[model samples]
Target: MIDMIQQFASCCRAAGLRISTSEILDCFRHLQLIDISDEMQFKTTLRTNFIKNYREQGKFDQLYHLFFHELRTDIEIARSTPLGSLVKDVLENLNQNPTDNPSKSILDFLSGDPIGFLEEIRSIQSEGNEPMQGPIKGPRSNLGSLARRLKIMLQIYAVQESIMNFLAENKSKVSWETNKNLKTYFSQRLDRARRYLHEDPPAYPDNSSHVTSYEKYLTQLGERNFASLTPKEVDEMRIVIAHWVRKLKDTIGLRYSRNNRGIIDVKQTLRDTMKYYGVPLKISYRKRPKRKGKIVTLCDVSGSVWSAARFMLNMLYSLQECFAKVRSFVFVAEMDEVTRIFENNDINEAIDKALKEANISYNADTDYGSAFRNFKRSYMDALNKKTTLIIIGDGRSNYTNPEEDIFDEMREKCRRVVWLNPEPKVFWYTGDSEMRTYEVYCHQIRVCGNLNQLMDFINDLVL
Candidate 1:
């Protein structure tokens, strides 16, 4: 039990949680006072000792779940039994000639220890890209980390196939029940590994404490990251957002109406004074421009970013009258204009349809450069000096060309380029992210990881 706890602590540390030696010792000391078999008490004790702040809670929870539940290799079969021997034999055969660290680590994980596999994943997640040099003019991406991950995934697939083949060959030797258990065991392990590899790390809370009075109602769910929201939370979010949109529309309408008189025109006022025998009988106010603001948004709908983007689009369309026009495009690897979808259908229905029926491939690798290039080619005419180009994405281009040149051109063509990144500031420049490269061209860049931040951006846009 102590060994398992210690190993779990090590895994937590590897996953970027600050688990100190003193804390581990304190956790052990406290564990002696409680019944360790009580899972709730056990988890609470560990979390209380290890988690330093609210920001670390999400990461700590993920690590704890992974180590305790996902990585447990608890097969009911006894080692003396034929099923156990077959399991051991299969692992031994796969491990006889280990090809690489990742494969070896995977096999070790299946064999009941996941410390090495966890470390491998940590290394990949934390790998930094090399600095850009003279000619490229952008960050030089290193696909070495991505390649390593792909290799690990392929190794998992190979292991799964090998396990199935071994079971097929030995089906007659073992009972049907034993074969079924063995297959289920290995399948679960491999699938967990695959899921852990594919999933993005939980977003750390934003460190900046820019509190606003508007976020008073948004006590809990408003601060929660969009990607971390459950289905119920999402439904709650939609309700809150609908109320917010209505409030904003009323507020903007009143504000615009209050300012209908526009600014005083000094020359016009003086000219009218001359007509009144040099005594100002009346003052003249310049007419406010009748043209409304126009917005063009390029939203990245690839997995994680999509969670935030949909809400942003919903708000933009719900308050569509605030702008003369709101043209939206969704993209994964390629751009697809979904402006018509929103125009024809109800806001929520449009958002759902856009997600499902957009002409881009969601499964394709995220290539921001490709998407930007496609947009420039097909929709360059959509932008004018009156248009504000808002881009909602994490800026992860997957080591592809960022095509900053085209972005620069788009900047010149539009009134302003505002980027709303769902990722925290700390992760902006890491891995395959091209945020640093594209940052120069943006007129404004905000971390819109939660409802408050998104609401703040929309408020600024409308008012």
Candidate 2:
């Protein structure tokens, strides 16, 4: 029982749940007080000792269900039953054929130990999105995992077929009941394996604040989530954003003018006094060097993230004169600079062209780590002390490595890094999101799920 608990804990850890050795000991201690035969009591005791946070309960429940219910068997039929020898014989025969050879993990699963197979699944699910490092580059996506899964599925099918063929050939040697039981047991185990491959783990519920107080404008659409917008609402939203852009431009100009007066430049004044023969006959007023704000925006154009990013990009370019230079980038698993798209075309036209023409793979999964690495490799020079780097995305890297070090480097190079997450604030740290990992490096993180939130951020940014 202790070994089983430890193994289950290992599985949970592999699936990205945080489990400690002390927790395992505590679980063992707790189990002694509960009736082990009572499934509910046993599960509750284990859950209490193992799970630390309410947010992690969903993952705990999934692993628990998978380990105790789906993977458990009533008896050790593979070793103790009379059919054990028959199963071994069949496996030996299957192994003899090189072309139909299954992966060692699959074979281990068939032989009754599923740990190897579970590890394979975990690895596949958590595979990194780092691109191939060579002269020749190719797009990266989830397809590699899918292909591996397909191969496993096919192998399972082959194993089932081989077992059926073996049973048919040796039917006379075993009783009818024995054959039926053998088929049913292997069938169930194989089916369980297939189901596990498809079962995506649930993400923790996001507990972030829904909305912040802002002056309400177009109350209905302004407050509505960007992901929930309809076609008509999106069109209406463009008009509203254009109006805001104009207002923001005027506001930026006014703010700049209000703060434009220079402080007394003592050195320049002293030099000018020398020209006046060291007398206070002529007074010289020093002129202020205009501060130019440069902005570099990296926007994730994947799925619903694009909904919020498009509007942000639109407003940024529409008020481009407010900034000395505005560079735009869009990314899915890879990033491409779209600054030129905006420069040569109208703001709306540029946005449309960026979506269609940017050298990015739209079908690939979101990989912020890869995008950051790519940016560092190609556009590291674009960042400077005067550049405000705004990253717009949901921060979901699909269980890939987040490469927070790269993000931290980015923060160092830029004036300030602001993350605008389109996902609800509650969902920022959930599932495959790398928000928490990258959050520490960001100057600010705002939940830009709606127009109001977006406006609030832009307002603060320019004014």
Candidate 3:
């Protein structure tokens, strides 16, 4: 029973739940006090020992369902006449073909050890998006994980077909009552596997609050995803953004004021003391410490997450004084410096010009792999230990190579990496999103689609 509990903890950890050794030990000690045959008490004991908070409970419950119910041993199915031998024969036939991951995982699911199937499901849910090989064709989708699930679903159907065919050929081998119960039990198990393919673990808040503490009036447009806003709403957003820029500036100024003052200048203090006949008079501090850190921004204006880039650019340039130098790059398939655009134009015009004439192929598919490669090849020198690299995107690389090595290299070259994903947290690992891939190297990941998220991020940065 303790071994079984430990195995369950292992499954939970594989599913991205943070189960610790101490928690498992606690679970072990607690289970000894409970009636193991009572399923509710058993589940409650495990849940109480492992799950720490409400947000994590959704994932915890899913893991529990997959572990206990879907993966339960089929002792009932095995006991009925020749059915056990029949199931073994069918599974042997299915395994005759060279098995891929989909086949292997489903086969594991049927044998009452759902660990392999659970692990595969976890991978699909957390799978990072990368480009699939082909032309820049029509409407593209990141269907790699989805496609794999469909294949497994077909395999499950095929197994049922094989079972039906076997029963027709050997009806005399098993009695009617045994056959009926056996088929029903296996059918229920297969249905459980089908449900696993469609199960959604949990989703974080999508369109949450628009009201920031600083905003006096409730902002209607602030809540909208930037890329989806209309022209009129865009104008309103600019007004709201101006206020944010000013507030960020004030906040930054306050930080510099409080933190950057240097050591006392003894020479200047003594010079002033002469006016008071050698008595200490006015004391003077040395100049403020140099704000020499660099901030490098890689904005994905891939049209999918367009609004985020415009406002993010507006914010970065407005608070340009916060850093010694600010470098901005925009990319879809390629990246190019757009600091000159902002340098020459007003904030609004610069943003418009960046979208229109930054020399990026706006029509091209987003290839984060290629973008990261280009950044490493061309602009790696711009990064230093004093640099903070901020990436703004949906992290959807259009099913292309993720090039996570380049990303990690850049991470090592900088003080920190911040990924501001405009996509809702729910959609992050879905489709072509490389959010999960890049998240490993990021110091922070924030949902930045709405103005509230943007405001919150800036508040963290400056306040």
Candidate 4:
């Protein structure tokens, strides 16, 4: 029972609970003070001993049931049966007569044929009894001690099996499906990926063939081509790459927009005042007025570029932490401002609303020309030298008129016209893609396929 309590405490600690030695000792003391005759009283004592917060009460209850709740029939039989003999029998039955019935559930095995199970448990106890050979008067049987130890062991086995079953049933809920060690590895990888996306980019391997000590095992996997890698390995690599890209973006802040007005440029301010060295500083300060900038994102949410659009939306959502004024627009055949949708806290809900508002269909063909023309006609006044315009799309017009005039007008009106194309540079003029024709009007044209490329493009924007 003492060992059982200690093990349960350990499990709670592993599950992010803060459990101290003092708490464990206090629990044991409380258990001794409480009457064991009443099950409810015993449970209350246990809860009072270990649980310090109401929030943790439910967690404690789960642990208690997992660790100490014995099979009712086992307890009844153990009370009457010779514990040593019963343990030996149970061990023999488990080893020699292991059940081959695949149809039986774990719960059934634990609860079914309780009398036979208890007898087998008692047999295991008997096998462990050793004769006393020291100053003891005679061979003494530590039957109660053996029984308690057996109980703890059984409880551990039951808990382990239960956890396995729970994991098997809930595998789909997890991001990665792998062995225990791999699952832990994937979780760490995910954490690293998220960190990279939001923080400064880390150094990449200088040499591809000369694998770093950290990823030596991964490099040794006999994979000659990226396509040949297993799905699990590919997913793992993708996560790592995604993290690297995210970190890169963090290191290189958005380049298109000017810094916020709240941030004072002491050096620039002082330089401007240098012309009035002998004059009043107030006059110079008045001459150099502070200016705020606006960020306008025009994302192509058409069927051709849905993946890239989703990624851009995610980045825009994350950018809310850095910027104050941000407006978003999604375009398929037409464009609609989705700033309010993005302003909502829930990203999934926001995206759904944005898609609905834009009437974006996954099957619809892209018409960047019409979308640009519509935006120019409806919101031309919104464009100014203070506004930074970011357009994310594949630059594919699906044989529609390129509408280069609208982009030309946009470049003249906006402070910057940045075009982010998901397709490679070679695909700019191929097929119905009008990227080559559209590229001439934009201040910067960047290839943004994956998160890394997108991060680099964003970094370049603020520069």
Q: Pick the candidate with the highest lDDT.
A: 1
lDDT of each: 0.86, 0.82, 0.79, 0.59
TM-score of each: 0.49, 0.49, 0.52, 0.42
Q: Write the per-residue lDDT of candidate 3 for residues 1-463, one digit (tens) a residue.
A: 7766877888887776788999898888898899989989999999999887666678888878776765645533544546666666656655675542226667666765677777777777665344444777444364877887777789888767665666666678778876776578668878888887787767544322333533544365677887787888778777887877887777667777785668899999999998999998687889886465688999998875777988888877887787789889989989998889889999889988888798779999999999999988998998999998999998898899999999999999999899998888999989988888999999999999988788888767655
Number of colliding residue pairs in each model: 0, 2, 5, 25
Write the residue-wise lDDT of candidate 2 on 37-59 in tens digits: 99999989888887877667887
Clash pairs, candidate 2, are 206-426, 208-426
User: TM-score of the candidate numbered 3?
Assistant: 0.52
Which candidate order results from sorting by lDDT in descending order? 1, 2, 3, 4
Leading candidate by TM-score? 3
Q: What is residue 201's positional error in candidate 4, in angstroms? A: 36
Write out the backbone clash pairs for model 3. 130-399, 130-400, 131-399, 131-400, 132-399
Ranking by TM-score: 3, 1, 2, 4
Instruction: Indicate the TM-score of model 2.
Output: 0.49
Query: Local error of candidate 3 at 352, Å?
Result: 1.0
lDDT winner between 1 and 2, please give it: 1
lDDT of 1: 0.86
Tens digits of per-residue lDDT for model 1 on 1-463?
7888898898887777788899999999999999998999999999999988877777778887877776553433424456667788888877774542227778887876777877888777666345666877676565867897898999898888877877898799888988899999789878888888878667776554544533454567899999999998888888988999999978976776676878999998998988779997897788786557899999999979999998999889988888999999999999999999998999899999998899989899999999989998899999999999999999999999999999999999999999999999999999999999999999999999998899999999888
Worst 10 residues of 1 by lDDT: 72-81
